[model samples]
Target: MAIAVISGCAPLIQLDSDAQPSTVNQVELGQGSGRMKNEQPLAHLYISDYDSAAVQNARMSGMKLPGYKPEPVVTVNHYVQSLMHDLAANLEILSTTFSVGVTSFVYLDGDYQQGDLLGNQLSEAFMHEATQFGMAVTDFKTTDYIRVTPTGDFTFSRDFLELTQQYPISVVLGGTLVRHQGGVIVNARMVNVMDKKVLASAQAFIPQNVVHALKGTHSAPLLQLKASQP
Candidate 1:
């Protein structure tokens, strides 16, 4: 099934500096920093599901309905991945780096919201998007932890560290979708998992009224999450 939207629940993106904030300490490349061309570039990256503070509050709150199924994060992993492809293409980095994870992904919806929920989990939609995008992706569990600042900075949660031990990912893609007074702001980033450093980042502002129209769907928000880039 689609990601169940909760009123005022969504991730917020940080929009500041050429660098995106991360819990991982920022690393500056010195004159001898080996990350230059001809060196082994960090190519096998991971793209994570976008998340927000509002979504977490609802899930942690103890008074939800029995059938309540909160979309833990903004359901836009594959979309963000597509954005990554665009980023790499524009930056001329795709030839050097690409995602190195499963092409097939599986969903873990803890609640039994639909009789055939498995048939319609957000993962299915993402799989379709991946196919359409011609991205070489496969089935694997994709879970990431991130925190955001009031002004739109990103920080990796401690839990995300545990995940690194299991996967060989060194770099990742992340962002936030925050509900604001006017509209939503997307603070997307390409992050280094090892040092929690931001490599490339961008921000987009989505008008609130449009979000309202999409939210009315009450279905998978992923089906209608569209943001602009410049």
Candidate 2:
């Protein structure tokens, strides 16, 4: 279930003013009448870009797919509520293992692909899982609409890191979801905030049976999913 369109890049790290001082002059922090005397560059804010063949081509060809529905901008409330519930659950679970406090989040590839509503739908489910685990999740969808730039990239890791450093989150998890073989797969990597190192990487696989259930049937979620962890 690899739904994400993969792109290549060098290993990522947060860009800082101290590391690249000239970047400060290049930053556009919105418009203003007068420039402030002292403006500090934000650090630990990671910027990333996500490009998917599905989304790019869908926009180009003006094509739509079956079982696809555009999410209404005016009424994204239901999706938000669903996301909150899932996020709460996820945070709750992490709390038992870690501190499980999340201040904010960013969705990199949420735009529709092939008229498919996978991104938003998956996010709602993910949020629900996070909430169930007992975490404080931010409303990134409403508060911040992380856009797909012309270069087809966006950044959120730096912000994630900053949150971790400030709040001293013991562990931080980040990942992507993709459609693969008529199903969906989520690949996640958990890192130690202090060391800034990856602690583990896991893949959540959704089988064909589970995918059918994703279409709105209650066919015993993950009933046939078998995984091994070390």
Candidate 3:
């Protein structure tokens, strides 16, 4: 009944198929200057920090510091589940005309107690979301769920990439869960592994009220996050 969610193989910096970094050719920039013009290819650039208000709001919604005291396990479970539900709903609404698959989710942490709970919650969320989009994930059991953490002095682990290679999933999800500014924030990034391109990115800012519910006291927050079909 108790799974060591945090006891994953190893946390390694693995690139999803779509996210494999492409070589960027550099050209000298400026007159008589040995600097490369546009030295960083726009493709190699992550987080361009565009002018979108929604994205800006997400960026501005900073993290809560030091993290709140670990709440009741039941409360954390509920909040995580609710988040999965909302995410699924949004995916369904967006998958109308586009081909979508709720494949796998990988979390970053070393706590198996917390990681196990989070992984189950995420799987449930993905399933619910898949239904909304009229997509059925056939290999849930075979699907890879990973928790990445460091060991000793090493900064990354090898098990992390192994799972990715095994699953060879098309959509990869990664992010963090933190308490910030009086609430819980789940910053998630969804990437298309095949092409190594970022398909969609989102940040869920659960206000204090939602946090209370997440802790088993209040109602789920009403934040609408819908992705348009490509």
Model 1 C-alpha lDDT per residue in residues 61-85, reported as the tens digit of each score: 5423323344444443434455555
lDDT of 1: 0.39
Each model's lDDT comes to: 0.39, 0.41, 0.41
What is candidate 3's lDDT per residue for 1-230, written digit by digit as tens?
Answer: 00011112211111222321232122332344233343422223223223323223333554221111223334443544455555554453444343344432333343423443333444556556555546434342332444445743333232444333444345654446554556557655555567867655566655545445422124444223335579
Superposition TM-score, candidate 3 onto the true structure: 0.34
Error of 1 at 64 (Å): 48
- Better by TM-score, candidate 3 or 1: 3
Q: Estimate each model's TM-score.
A: 0.32, 0.29, 0.34
Candidate 2: segments with Cα more than 4 A from true spot: 1-116, 144-173, 191-196, 208-230
Which prediction has the highest TM-score against the true structure? 3
